[model samples]
Target: MSDGATTRVVIIGGGFAGINAAKVLARDRRIAVTLIDRSNHHLFQPLLYQVAMAGLSPADIAVPIRGLLSRFRKVSVVQDTVTGIDLEAKQVSATGQSWSYDYLVVATGARHAYFGHDEWESNAPGLKTLSQATEIRRRVLQAFESAENEEDPEVRKELLTFAIVGGGPTGVELAGAIAELSRSTLTKDFRRIDPRRTRVVLIEAGPQILAAFSAASAVRATRDLEELGAQVWTESLVTDVSEDSITIGNDGEKLRTRTVLWAAGVHASELGSALSGELDRQGRVPVGADLSVAGHPEVFALGDLARTEDDSGAVLPGVAPVAMQAGRYVGRLIRAELAGKERRPFRYVDKGQMATIGRSKAVVETGRLRLGGFLAWAAWLLIHIYYLSSFRNRALVLVQWAWSYVTFGRGARLIVDREWRNPET
Candidate 1:
């Protein structure tokens, strides 16, 4: 490989896949890696719901990307938005600069899709980035503030009602956290209207929420949500979302609410289109078993940007573990190829999945084992804390969670951006 010359590797997107790949490549001094991302920080997206729910601050679930890779002398981090990629020229065009690489890794993640209803995003924000999470937090917390000063009962009811579209983990977790925030945390804090009377409606277009999980687990989660005083509506589709109302199903049943959060569907990053290969319906690039694009071995895609499959021919879900594993695998594969060793096909080890419903409610599935309630919640907590980017963040989150569990108090509930004017007015 280049007769022992330095090999430049450019990785786009400082997500789990890109970061992990850089970490693997850093071990080899021959490979100089440059990682680029739009954000300065590497966001722990699974806990983004916590930020939106005001349970954890943005810093708690994010770490500076530069800081993560600073210790690796061979790796350099750049914060810039990637605009285009030229596979033939082996160059990447960013905001005002371009980078040439011997090998390229594209791991730019997915964003929330509105299912052709892009205009609804102004009224209903989806949680993906830190900004989106904080925006949701502002809207959720602001709704209560607005409801407190409203004199009309109907207006107050509308303000107190929160609707979440999509019943996936994000939607389910959001519904549970909002329920707890209104019923328990803000119960005694508010005066004019009863916070405990707040309504949380989870609308799912599919027959069941968390379809990725087992049927029993989905049922348990739905029951747990219902117990938290949140309504679960299945087989319902949202036709339209307005400033203060949402029309669902063919009958156009309208729900009046100032707050609506979208967690329904997500398409791959638009960068997938910049590549040469044919993209799937979700805009994911079709990658071979080696995680390389068809006809372009030097160009690789990972995480949500690529549609990867397991040895069993089952398409792998775009999750953190899959991305992390793929990143490590790609890094090692590159190293092996450079060293003139045999390259191995990427094989993801199934690590199972878990989702937390509330404080002590959760569901976990690993191989043939299944768990729910407190034990599952404990597993979820430990696993998430362990996966946090930095030890300081983990400790901070653990302490905050412990304090919240003991006192039913959320310390990061400060609303930063204030919208004074009422939506209806």
Candidate 2:
């Protein structure tokens, strides 16, 4: 609005998709871009668990948005929550202020869903944002320090046990990292309770863990998890969660763990549901082949929030590559529109999927190639570092990973907050 000649483009998220879009759009001098996010920095979500486990710092995985676009005079970043959009006026309302835009992009991402039992969220938390990761980090380290001094064996055991309520990549990675923290790093720290005796249980309602992967890969991951002394409870469902214990389905099994990480499922953030458009049961707006919302050419949604089916009628999975590709595609489409040309439909370029299990163990599927174990782990590590935004982040992550690999130690282990009681009650 400040410049009469500049066409204002408002992006309502700063995650993978939004950041990439801004970076791409900054190339043009006529476009005025404003990126709005709740936080100042863009986060690398893939390695968030590493931050939670103290292997990486917040600065390592997060880069300040303004720092990224310092030289791009046409770009501006705002840390604010977008509350509403005026479709007719082509304006956005956020942080109690309104801004008009010629084009709008929604990339607000997703959050963990509690299904119908919303009250269960307090007891079981998920890792998503930077603050959530930091809280989990504090809780994880505090659990160890608490278990070190507790007198009652049952209480100490409860404090030591950890339950992860999903078997996906985030769940698997967190479980493995915590397991290593207990089995290897703290094996010699405590005298009262053997830290290696800490129990980590992964629960899933599906028939198998890593359901996204092939049956062979999932089965192998299950075996590897068990080999690492983590209890992989397939076909297990969580019926109830309390501060002290998790009730496991109709089955009588219960894990008395003070800490539970929710990685089971995620629903699109509030922005998606706010749109008066047709949406799936998961709250994602079903998009056409061109990745545009039906009937809305001025509005585009990307990242985990948009459900876009490919030519085969299969919806693309919510992954980093999908969002990044969608962002780049949308940026180009906007460019086409500016040039008085018709926009082309979007097509996702699948760069493959990979998940690391434990030390030197991973599964990767790229093109026709399927790899596992050490080779896959190396590939996964390289790919994550390469996609990171900052060269400093890449260097820091590489150094931290190298140190972790060599010493079997995690660095960002400081607990900045005190634990609160009655986590569920």
Candidate 3:
């Protein structure tokens, strides 16, 4: 490697995959690591919905990348937007700087895909980063505030109506939380408008929501959403989206609403284009069984940026656990190579999958075991809290959840954006 003494490793992300890779590589004194990301913080994406729902703040689910890896002297965190990658030179080009590396790990994540309708993004925003979550929180809260002052009945109804596209985990969680906020938390907050009458519709293009899960789980989740006053619309396609309305299905049915959230599809990060390879339909780079790029032994890809498969030939889902596992695998593989040991193919362990509905409502599937209701919700809570970046965040989130459960209140509902104005104003 570099100088024949230590291997210079460069990681192009600070997400779950990048952090875990650094953690593993830092233990070896022979490896020098540099982690780069556009954002300074390592975000807990699983809990991003909470921030969007006003159940938690941004700081509660995000921690500075430098702070998390401060103890590791070999790791250096850099905040920069990567522009390109040169395979021949083993260099990563960022906004205004470039770095050379002996081994490279690219874990850049995915972004929302509009399926050829890029203009819709202006009206319906997706939840991925901290700013997007806060913007959603502002929109949801502002809808209610606008409804309170609107003198026209039709306009008020439209303001109180919320439409969430996609019935996946993110969409289901968001719909449930918004329902609870409108019906339970903010019911008595508005004088002129009855927040309890708010209508939430979750639209899915598939025949059923949570299509990735079992049919039984999907049915149960649908029932739970219905019980919370959120309507679940399946087998529907959004044909058009406007500033204050959405058109759906071939029948040309239109829904009038001011707040629409997108959770539909995701394409791999644009950084994947910098590499020379055949990309999948979602723009993910194809990786070998060892998570290395084709024909490039020194380069590796992980997380949503790479299309990976298990031993059984089943493509792995792009989730946090898969990314973490792949990151550790890459680190160990690099270490083994340094030690002149035999390389082993990576193996992914399918732990389980979980999705939370509203309070005390969730579904969990782990191997042959299936759980629902309060017990599943408790398990989900514990697992998420245990996986949080730090003890401080875990404690804060626990306290917030406890307080919200007891009081039926959300404390982080403030809209800090000065440019956002109520339509009725």
Candidate 4:
């Protein structure tokens, strides 16, 4: 597949956008693609909360990048951390190497933002990566383990309380899963502390949870969460997050809890700043209608890192579908150029949005089709399962879900981390 005369395409960050871009570009024999990422695998980020809550293993939601690209003869996978970019030279500099490219695709994605309080990151862990999910899982399960041996009732109560910052999908899912995990999974497992009594608080500065969703859906989700025993606190700003607790509001209403999971906000990945371009407040680079960087048409920015508005002037939301579609468009554009075909502007098709609260509880929005409760939940499950990269993962996840549903027990509940060794001490 090596044509002596070929276009060198370098894609950074093997996330949804990068992967999709590479897949599409691989079809062109004249395009030699190199995909680089810090991580070796492509993660299904939507299901990362399940991993954090011990409902799914890391392997269940991730596929190796090398394996994914093995079929594509022209595409090479590189495992390296991209440090910076040399736009003038048209090359990407990683930790140990630098590669020149005829065209570049930046899909580095975003990371958890603590709203200028970077110090809070240590106190309240965010669920963005597999390691963070495992760490949260460790802290969550260890809290119960330490509470079982704790003598002081107040200390035990503090250990039992789980506070989550942000009321978005991640926060809501975590709150619901924590509540269900306490009431169902760990009910008979713990002898000293009744997991059912575990306090789960979801703190949101916004007026409603899932602010992107319909207000009706938000109300329904709030009710469902409350029914599961999670305290949903809206218009509550977290001022400070200390090791033992988090302080909320100007009134400094402190909630003492050992575990704090952050799902608050995210800023674009640092890679966006590598190029000399205008960045939005959220650090996203503004791309053209074709998803190309301004003044640098050969350079493309995809996924959460790129900011583009629709025809109605509403900016596209940072979701998987948007990224995938953008990647596909860029790929087609590049191919069209190579083939001397006319290129068209990229357009995002607004597919419906869905979020699951807990078992048999979810919300779905698709044009005029609004679904909730068991129907939405089932749809959520099937959609996620279908999107999984491999058939093996789909089968494994389905089996795990079935087992967890039947027995009300989480299969991946093992707390395997060094921090758990003497967490309370």
Candidate 5:
């Protein structure tokens, strides 16, 4: 404790790292902790696409921050947006309130990055928040609705074309789910335009999709995506995006589309750059071995917001396991501090990595084991359900999966949004 009083540790961003770390820190009675984030709920971000695709609902993947700590008296949860961090004062000012802390943990996670083309954000929005996912669902369903009334084939094709930039997990999942949605869910509903003929493109600047995974697995996933009727374009760079179309490279050529969904690049949250520390090109702070920002003993960073290499010097992938392990470590380090013990440098223990391409197409990579296809898909399902916030969510997601498997259809596919009434138009 500072000045022989209670030490306060304030954590910013109530993401996986912040929430888990807060849970650990609050277990101790020696210090007081405050967890802050813009949202009142901790989101299961990996499953956000499910919500967007109508496989799940908002309440399925999120738990309110205030309700999570009903039994923990030491942990205080605050919902607010942090504008900046005052390193000198060791205080966090957000929502017109200033919170003082003896130590700080910066877990503010990432937002979608537009890669210096801020204008593109307006035309092709990215899905990083629950609101964005809901908006995308609304736009997607609205596209079908608008196409039903339009007579122009050109406009109809534009409405049918769904372009996803970046062949990463989000893009791949979206393409697959939307493919299923078109071929299965909306098949009998649309009479004018064939949702089956809907052109979904997964564009990537890299040579292959799932660049972080094994090349062979990426190849398998590519084949699976092709089977699912998604045009997987590798080495295809996007030049521009608009409401009517997107300009993407096509085998030394160019092509256009109506809708564009950005799954391309996502840097660390802006909170990383606001800190008084050396930031990497991706906006991740180069955390010390112990996960502390350089020259700032009171401040620590983890999750997507931190860039820390392992003992072999290979930087860990920005995956969920990495965040969980880092959160556990930082919590221990803070506990050591409270006990008046010297904290050791953090060492990462990589569990493994897996990505699901579609329902039955997945890839799992561990130390020496590599699994793909249905086996990998099963593994992915179990792992995701295991990590989900509550048993209720796990059960609901499992039921949804089983129902989808048998019926070859999706539930919760509704376009719920405020009706547009444009006065200017």
Candidate 6:
């Protein structure tokens, strides 16, 4: 293998996949690693719901990308939005500059898909980034404040209603957390309005919530949400969403809610289309067995921007584990190639899936184990804490969780934005 910057590696996106890939590649002193991302921080997206629900601050989940990579002498970070890829030139063009690389790793990730209703985004914010989570938190907290001062009963009722579209893990978690926040956290804070009477709804167009999970797990989660005073509406399509209300199904049933959170679908990053290849329906580039684009051997795509089918021809779900495993796999694969070793096809390890629904409630699905309630919740907490980037973040999260459990107080409840007026009011 050539040494002293003989090979250049450029990794787009500082999410789980790119970060892991850079870490692995940095071990080879012969290769220089450059990780580029628009944001300076690497956010742990799985716990973003907690930020939106005021249970955790943004800093508790996001760590500076550069600081994490500072120890790696060969790894450098750049802050820029990727515009497109020049495959023939082996270069990536950003906003103001371009960088050539011997190997390119695309892990730009995905954004929320509103299906065909792109206009609904302003009214129904999705939980994806730190900014989006903070916006949703602002809306949620402001809704309560607005309800407290409003004299009209109808307006108060509208302000107290929270509607979440999509019944996936994010939607379920958000609904349950909002329910708990209303029934528990904000109960004593409001004087004129009773937060306990707030309405929380989860809408899903599918036949059941958490369709990816087993039927029993879905049933258990639905029951858990119901116990928390959240209404789970299945087979309910959100036809229209506005600042003040949302229309569900073809019958045009209007739900007057000031807060609407979207967690329905996600589309791959625009960089997927910029690459020279056929893209999946969701704009993800289909990779070969080695996780490289068909035409470009040096170009590899990982995480949500990549679409790969298993032996059974089922597309792998775009989860954090998949991204992380793919990242490490690609990193090792590149190292092997540099060492003149035979490269192997990428394979994913099925680690299991777990989703938390408020306190002491969760659903976990393993190979032969189906756990729910406290056990699953504990497993979820431990797993997330273990996967967090640093010990400090894990410690902060654990302490915050314990304090919230005992006192029912969310320390990150402060709404810093004062000028964001509620359009519904």
lDDT of 6 by residue, 195-276 (tens): 9999999999999999899999999999999999999999999999998999998889999998899999999998898774
lDDT of 1 by residue, 1-425 (tens): 22358998999999999999999999998999989998898889999999999989998988899998899998889988999999989899899999988999999989878898888888888888888888889989888999999999999999999999999888999999999888899999888989999999999999999889999999999999999989999998999999889999889899999899999999999999887458987889989999999888998999998999887788899899999999999999999999999878899998899888978899999999999988999999999988984646688789899999999998888899654322111
The candidate, 2 or 4, that scores higher on lDDT is: 4
lDDT of each: 0.90, 0.83, 0.91, 0.90, 0.81, 0.90
lDDT (10s digit) by residue, model 2, range 193-262 = 7888889998888998888888878887777777788889888889999999999988767789999888
Model 5 misplaced stretches (Cα beyond 4 Å): 1-4, 249-254, 419-425
In model 3, which regions exceed 4 Å deviation?
418-425
Assess candidate 6 and give its TM-score to the true structure. 0.97
lDDT of 3 by residue, 106-161 (tens): 99989988898978987998889888888899889999999999999999999999
Tens digit of per-residue lDDT, candidate 5, span 178-215: 77777778889877878888888888999999888789
Candidate 2: residue 304 lDDT (0-100): 94
lDDT of 1: 0.90
The candidate maximizing lDDT is 3
The 10 consecutive residues of candidate 1 with the worst lDDT sum are 416-425
Which stretch of 10 consecutive residues in model 4 shows the poorest summed lDDT? 416-425
lDDT of 1 at 208: 96
Candidate 1's error at 271, in angstroms? 0.6
